[model samples]
Target: MSPTTPHQPVLLRLLHSAIALLVFGSLLTGFMVYDRYDKRFGTLNLPIVPNTQGIHGTIALTFLILLPIFAVYCFHIGDRRLVQSQSMQQLGQQLTEVGKPIWWVSLQRLTNTFMLIAATLAVVTGRMMQEIWLPTGELNHIWYIGHLISWIIMAIGIALHLLMSTKVGGLPLLLSIYHWRIRESDLPKNWLKGFKIKPNSSIALIIEFVVIGGIALAFLLPLFVTA
Candidate 1:
């Protein structure tokens, strides 16, 4: 009999869906915002979007709100899917050699880690931006540039992520993340009882806290600043 494909945990799937939806939504609206306001690179033939900045900001804000939870889960419960201590060493191995499986797995882990880093950069820099900066023709702000670069990186990272996943696990593995079936132990009600969330490594714990804390600070900074 053929082996059943492994399924991702329900929490990861839900968070992933929410974050991915908002990321793409933000990216689309962000392009519209750029098209309507700044065209330093070049302009698309698109028409002006009404309040595109507002729509982009709203989508990005929703992504920010959900990001911390997802970061925590990936760092803790799903750390295996992220780059490990020996990831570099694994990468040093030849793909055509004996460690082909480990090399590919390590590459996938690195891609996931890269995407998470890109997402965080996009979110934090985005939070630092003033909506008026673009519309007022003040487009050279460091934060805005950072945000745009991060957006590009995240878009590329997402593409690489999908490509690597297909390379490693094929269609079934790609579809596993969207599966709706839930295991009993992974149910939300069983969380506290099971303490299912445990950091796989101290570095992951630190990275998770730093990401969540940094994002939390980004939101609170504007509330206190008089300028």
Candidate 2:
């Protein structure tokens, strides 16, 4: 079976779907909160929800919890795809190699990595931001600025991720993450069978570790900040 068409493993599919839903929820509520509370650039004409801040905070909390779980799953089960190829030549060659097996040495890796980074930024900055602070019209906090930048990064990263996924794997690959059917062999019961770390160079591993550490720090840093 082609990499693009193979049935996604059940466990991974579940995790992916949950993460996607939470991310979407977080993004939507986040936009609404931004529009209602902070319109420094240009105000959105959409109906303002008075409670959007609460909704946004709720969704952000859920996203924060899910992200670490997804990160661990991706790191262990899917880290190879997050790794970049050593050379631009290899990446370029992979781009040209349509119909080749799905591997880490492609533009998809770049998009995936960027999306993870953006999401991490969003979660960290979101956590650092206070709902009361926004309602008071205080838009000058460093963390709030970081959160705004993360929102932009996340928006671009998500759009690029979808576009590249379509170009590389088409609709089937996209749907595979949420597909209902799972072959018995691909069931959760078989999750660990024959599973092994996908080959990645030391440099790739190091990069992945650094990114993960950054994400961890993002989640933990606010705890140390004094009021």
Candidate 3:
């Protein structure tokens, strides 16, 4: 790909960074909240971090404020180049070939759209629970259930997005978020020439293991310590 606008690249990098932090931190805190409040499931306990309620609520609100800004930036400047990118086009073609019903597309889009909205709601409700601003409710079971359901759906959407991205060289796109210094030679010479990146399989595996293990350990540590 040819060099993109400097401002746009910088903005994309910032948005990506913020989103990554929010997602990881919020997921960790969510597990903590589950462990503390919903202990019926024996496997749910984890002590990777303490004081999770406050930490999670804070991060959620921070992300809530950041999302609209990122969304607007994405709409105004980001999505066009991203959608037109060779990787994304290939990914779309693969999805189309999957031969799922039209409802699948509709459902995916609906779930994704509402997942963002639901995340916002979860953040707001979490803040209310924290008394950081004002109480929205009494923190009843229904509200907690809604928050958990929304989070699960959002996580599912994220997983789907990751799976689909792999078809379109997802690792490179992910790397581009952090490593922006692509050589000019790496660019596609023509539409016929494909874009490719060096495969660092060991690094990839380490990252995968760390993330999956971190989440699992976050849940199990508390139980082992207690035992």
For this target, which candidate reaches the highest TM-score against the unseen true structure? 1
Model 3 lDDT tens row, 1-227: 22332222655676768976897789878777766656454445566465566787778767766766654444334433222223223435554455343323433433333444545555533433333211233334544656666677668767765554333334664456676554543344522232223212343334334433433443455455431
TM-score winner between candidates 1 and 3: 1
What are the runs in model 2 whose C-alpha is more than 4 Å off? 1-4, 92-105, 193-199
> Best candidate, lDDT-wise?
1
RMSD of 2: 3.4
Better of 1 and 2 by lDDT: 1
TM-scores for the candidates: 0.88, 0.84, 0.56
lDDT of candidate 2 over 1-227, digit per residue (tens): 23556477787887788878888888788777778878887777679777888887887877777777777666667665665455344565644664454533366777787787788878777777777888898989988899889988888888988887777678887777787886886766787665446535665566556656766776787799742
- Give the whole-model CA lDDT for all candidates, comma-separated: 0.81, 0.73, 0.51
- The full ranking of all candidates by lDDT, starting with the best, is 1, 2, 3
Error of 2 at 222 (Å): 2.4
lDDT score, residue 203, model 3? 35
Collision pairs in model 1: none
Please list the Cα RMSD from the true structure of every candidate, rounded to 1 decimal place. 2.7, 3.4, 14.8
Instruction: List the pairs of residues colliding in candidate 3.
Output: none
- Candidate with better lDDT, 2 vs 3: 2
Better of 1 and 2 by TM-score: 1
